[model samples]
Target: MSPTVASTGRVPVTIGAMESSSAASGGSTRREATRQKLYEAAVTLIAEQGFSATTVDEIAERAGVAKGTVYYNFASKSVLFEELLRHGVGLLTASLREAAERTAAEGGNKVDALDAMIRAGLVFIDRYPAFTQLYVAELWRTNRTWQSTLMVVRQQAVAVVEDVLRDGVAAGEFSEEIDISLTASALVGMVLVAALDWKSFQAERSLDDVHAALSRLLQGRVSGCR
Candidate 1:
């Protein structure tokens, strides 16, 4: 399982099982730090110029690590990006799962769980804008080497939303006519696009403001007028 952004502090191993290869506690910490740096560098470059344009050397330089360090941690740039996509999306999925579980534990309904998942998505995007941007851009494109791996990761995250929606439908909170899978995908898309828009084009709006807007839309309070 990939560690959360908060727990792992935003980065780690790829290209191989380098993260867990070290058994010494001190060495493991250092290795984890190096991997994090590399991930941070890779995500920024890939998000800016894209995976094809970004190189290992550039990632190493941006990470303040030697070229061999990149090789030491990851087998290749593709592996690095693959691990990155897995790790980032894994964190998002885990976050949503925890939020849903926590909400349910607190006697909240599936609608509340869904709301928590949406906010969790926003928070994840806010913390890892580069990863979110890269994923959003690449998600619809075809023929990429990493696309298949990413699809599985994408499904894991979306499944969290689908679970909550399914519960809502079963409990009569949501309409039986709702297509749970489609609605879940739409909700995930909504959070991703809204977060990117807020970060890229709508700097004046606060995160709270954006969240409120999304919450209203989810609660069916927004008018359908175009």
Candidate 2:
């Protein structure tokens, strides 16, 4: 599960699949909390300092855990970062899926579902800017031990947006001329970059303001009346 940026001032977030597996493994709540601290510290430091520049001692100090605790949860810094990527991306995918499914259940049209997802994306980044920052920086960087895993996790989230676009095209809600896969990737990129930009440089802007901007962008993409 991705750690929410402490600066978002939001409640702690679930760690998606990581929570379940760790629980079933008989890991105690104390261990989980320690791991959560490690994740939070790691993402923030790595986001600011880059993976290699950040050290286990720094992570431990940030988390208020000992250096030994970092080793207890993860064998190496790379392993912790790898699991952090999985947990973070897994939560993102889950959020998108939830937004889409819930919108559909509420009788929202495909376009509405897509809009809800866009808002979800915004909320996610607002709550986890550190993770978003780290992800965007490392996404295209090759030669990293976890680069392949990161790509897979990224595709999982993109696939959610792609499915929405695909459905819209099938129902004629979207232009058939649209390339759903490419558009999906573009949409994901747009939200991530926009959220990062807003959070970093436009702190005065309301979340709704950012959401509305992206929503307008998406609406403009439709050929017919939205």
Candidate 3:
């Protein structure tokens, strides 16, 4: 006969493990949802009223969160804006990265990858015109904190572009002599200019037309054929 022992008072290991995992996942999901809502509110307010005129309280209200929640997630208005800028940049970068990955999977040329990246940027800017205005407004700001934060976010995109450009050069699809850093910055500037111009003069131009022209510009292509 097998000897039977009394059950311990502690919870079962399997049940305990499941409960912990569920609690952790639920907490993470809630945090992410809250953060997303806050980000959306911040973008909408900044776009509508410009960054300078927008207040943290307004963002909190718009997000349907207590003001303390905003402070809890972001230390200050500057930090909040920095996060917003990062989020916007992330959206564009992810779009570009996805396009690049897809092109690579199909064994497409580097120029195709680069063009897709540029087109992704154009699509993002066109979709977020007001955010573009806020971004440009921040360009002239003299605040040291803001400047540093912008530099950090700008570097993130620059690094991504540099990696892609380096790959293009390695594959012999792009000129090795081209300055990757300068070219990336120039490409970014062109996107900004085209997007701003299109939004500033909505009646005169459409985003699709601008994106087509800009894509060709980035590709160094013209009707005359090299």
Candidate 4:
């Protein structure tokens, strides 16, 4: 049989898959945490001292990892920055997915679920402003790898939102004629743009205010008249 096995009777087969996954997950999580620390250090230093002058050595020093460790984790400064962008995107994706899944499980409608996701994204950026700033700064860079990775992440977000909208349409809560895929992406884009612009306003406004604004915008744009 394959190395990975599905469970059967009480004590019939092997636990290799479980062991392997546990080990792999442990290793991957440790590495990911290390990489995150280095990314945070690099972003912090770059934000403080400008990217042109922020050396990888200083990042390693601040992250308390060896210089070679940094190199092993990321090929070079640019790759490190790329991974930092990926990390930030990954954080937002995870948060959005969890919130959307929870909302769906609770029988929330598509528009309500999407509003929760938008709020989650705002909260993620608020919680990790340094990482979010790094991502925003390099968003328009012409780096192909970064561009492709971001596109993939954005596509995933669009796919999830599309699924939610399609479900809503099936449940007679949304307009079936609407292009759910494009509408979902457009909704995400609107929230991202608005939240980026509203970051400065966050100091004076609460998250509830931001969520309410996004809820109104999305409900107006995507909600059915039923």
Q: Which one is best on lDDT?
A: 2
**In candidate 1, what are the lDDT values of residues 1-226, reduced to their tens digit?**
3432223343342222234556565455667777877887788889999888888889888778899988898888898888888877877787889999999999998878888888888887777788889988888888988889988988898888888888888999888999988998889889888999998898678878888899999888898735
Question: Candidate 1 has what TM-score?
Answer: 0.86
Give me the overall lDDT of model 1.
0.81
State, as a TM-score between 0 and 1, how close model 3 is to the true structure: 0.74
lDDT of all predictions, in order shown?
Answer: 0.81, 0.84, 0.71, 0.68
Q: Write the per-residue lDDT of candidate 3 for residues 1-226, one digit (tens) a residue.
A: 1112124242111100112234655555566556656766777678678877889889888778899998887889888888777666666667778878888898888878777777777776766665666777776577557787777766877677778899989988888899999988887788888777776777367667887898777765766556
All candidates: TM-score = 0.86, 0.88, 0.74, 0.71
Task: Give the Cα RMSD of candidate 3.
Answer: 12.9
Q: How displaced is residue 200 in candidate 1, in Å?
A: 0.6
* Candidate 2 weakest lDDT stretch, 10 residues: 8-17
Per-residue alpha-carbon lDDT of model 2 for 110-221, expressed as tens digits?
A: 9899999999999888888888898999998888789899889988998999898988889888889998888988888889889989989987899999888888888885
Q: Rank the models by lDDT, top first.
A: 2, 1, 3, 4
Which is superior by lDDT, 1 or 3?
1
* Alpha-carbon RMSD, each predicted model: 4.8, 3.6, 12.9, 10.8
- The C-alpha stretches of model 2 lying farther than 4 A from their native spots are 1-18, 22-27, 221-226
Candidate 4 ranges beyond 4 A from true positions = 1-34, 45-54, 64-66, 140-145, 221-226
Superposition error at 145 for model 4 (Å): 4.1
| Per-residue alpha-carbon lDDT of candidate 4 for residues 89-178, written as tens digits (9 for 90 to 100) | 665776788988898899887777877888888887566655555555655567555687767755665676777788889989887798
